[model samples]
Target: MKIIAYLDAGRIALGVVTSPTHFIAVADVAPDLPTDLIEILEREDGMDRLREATAGRTGDRLLADVTLKPFLHRPNAMWALALNFKSHIAETGLQTNPDFPHLFLRTEASYVGAGEPIFAPPYSVARAFDYEGELGVIIGKPGRDIPVERALEHVAGYTCLNEGSVREYQMHNRQFGLGKNFEASGSYGPWLMTPDEFGDPARHSVLTRINGVVRQRAPLDDMLIDVAHTVSYLSRGYRLRPGDLIAMGTPGALKPQPDDLEGQDLSRQFGPFPTPGLVHMRAGDVVEIEIDGLGVLRNSVITDPAFEGDL
Candidate 1:
């Protein structure tokens, strides 16, 4: 079943989306939910409990009339995957760093819900803000040193991740984390599909669209390190708590290349402008990140802080 966290009217809620026009309210089955989505994921057999709770009440509600919030609330942290795509390395003209699993962090505060507005930081601290559409791995269980063979067992499911970056802050810090973790920048989810629905995370299709134009397309097999490998590797040192998001880095065609600079004369050699990096977000731009099975997250960019409401 496809599960979604939505903001209907003015209240936030969890829903079971069965089809375009049908769904069942989790509250109708198990009313007065005390815990958030992350907490629901951490509990033992929470998936089964969610299924059982919503089982007998399917197809009783209409889908079109209601709105969707489509974001995970209060995840522990968002982890980054660098150089996970082999083609990405070749495209950028950089030899693969020997580092097995390059990692970084985006604070929880940076998250924005699907259909929500992405704020442009007022200070103009970053001129080259870029987008990296990625497949998000949502961990369901707490584990330490999880074996590679059983890594998938710890995953709750997958969601769409728009990994926005500020090239200025990122390169200046000499660390990827601080640059990527700007408040209200990253966007996630319309729903968190269960593993049963998201099947074979290792092999799937990913596409990125800017203003309804397709820009990047690749297969999950192209990943140098797949989801299972990332989960197992990450669990080795960091104790992956429930609701921790693991972004399985962007693939080829999205990374910056020299060819994009062929037509126009660049003013400066370094910094945001002439780099031919990923698409830079601005006011009124709608960016869409879609996975083959999971739903699409449609969001618009706006600078006004008034646009944000509790999700």
Candidate 2:
């Protein structure tokens, strides 16, 4: 099952996406249910209730006509994996502790919804606005110290995540605080596909594109740390409640498309990159992330005009 939150003539409406272009308002299926996706997931039988109600249903609303909103604009807590994919670790020459997963928090403002523009820090601020496309795991059950064996049971669904990074601020320190949390720098959701629908994470791959050129692509099986372990590891410190989001880390950059620069020329065009062939996102470029069979989250890049010093 696929679910979404969108603007319906200025009001927020929860929906179940029936196809790439259509969705059924949850209000139509069950009027008493909460419009918030997080709120719905918080209920023990929320998904089951909605699932039964919308069974054999088809979407009545056109997806293109509605403005999309972040499915969980304010999740209880949002965590992301860093260097979980060994391929990514090799590309940046970064290391992670062998015993534990490298983790970080992202604020609500750091993400926009699908079809919205992801902000790039102004040129004067930073230019390494890179994209990390990863699988987004949405917690269904609240638990602490969740065992790795039972971790999959706690998941409600999955979504695509573009964990945008401002590399300049990221390298300023090791905390991964500022650079990783820039306002509106990332996005998730075209829609949320439930566990049964999404199937195995390892069977799929994440493919990221800047404009029309593929920049990152790799099979999900390549991750050094998998989803079950990531959830279990995070639960050790805090109880993961329903609506907590976890980005499962992105894979390494692929060979650049023929139209893009190569070698020193690539560096000259996008400034120095820690890894060659890294293409920093620029204003007016459309970024799209696709997790096979899960659907695509697409956003255009725009430099924020806020906090400018008279341009």
Candidate 3:
């Protein structure tokens, strides 16, 4: 089952996506239920309750008629993996970290919903802005020290995430906090697909396109650390609660390297370089991330208007 969070009559509400463009508001069937998607998922019988609430009801609202919101507005924690895909590491020419998964945190303010604009901060206009298309995992159950074998049981569903980045700030320090947490620089949503319908997350594929041209594509299984490992690793010292989100790392374009640069000053050419074939996003560009079965997450790029500095 697919669940969508959207605005209806000026208030946030939950809907069961009956079709690509149609849904039935859960409130229409269960008026007393909370509108927040996180609250709904926290309930022990959330899925069963949702199914029972919308059972036999024809979708009464058009998806196009309402404004969609991020499936989870404010998750308990938003964690992202860096260099999880072998192809991505190879593209960047970085040594693989074999000991553990590289993780980062993102604030809720950094992400906008699908169909919303991803603002290119004035500082990123030159050559820093970048995009990383990834699969988003939504945690359904709270757990601590979760075993890898039972990790899948804690998953509620999945969604698409565009891990927007600012390369300059990222390279300025060892920590990626400033570069990744820019306001409205990334996005998530459109809807959530339950685990039953999503099947094996690693069996899927992810594709990223900018202005309608493909930039990154790879199968989900390419990750060095898969979803189960990620869940287990993250839960060791931390308690993961329902509504926590994990962004599986993105795949990078494996463009052929130039032979001329083989032995010449490798240090200058290797780190945090602009991804081949992908340039900084300019105003009016549309970026789309498509994951097989999860649906497409599309957003337009716009220059931030609040900045006072010259671009």
- Using lDDT as the measure, what is the rank order of every candidate, best first? 2, 3, 1
Instruction: Please estimate how well model 1 matches the true structure, expressed as its whole-model Cα lDDT.
Output: 0.73
Where is model 2 poorest over a 10-residue stretch in terms of lDDT? 263-272
Candidate 2 clash figure, as a count: 0
Model 1: residues with Cα > 4 Å off, grouped in runs: 8-11, 32-35, 60-67, 95-99, 254-277, 304-311
What's the CA RMSD for each of the models?
A: 4.3, 1.7, 4.1
Worst 10 residues of 3 by lDDT: 262-271
Once model 2 is optimally superposed onto the true structure by TM-score, how far is the C-alpha of residue 210 displaced, in angstroms?
Answer: 0.9
Candidate 3 accuracy as lDDT:
0.83
TM-score of 1: 0.86
State every prediction's TM-score relative to the real structure: 0.86, 0.95, 0.91
lDDT of each: 0.73, 0.86, 0.83
Best candidate according to lDDT: 2
lDDT string for model 3 (85-177, tens) is 988887778775766778999989889888989988774343567889999999998899999999999999999999998777788788886
Stretches > 4 Å off in candidate 3: 123-126, 254-271
> Which residue pairs in model 3 clash with each other?
none
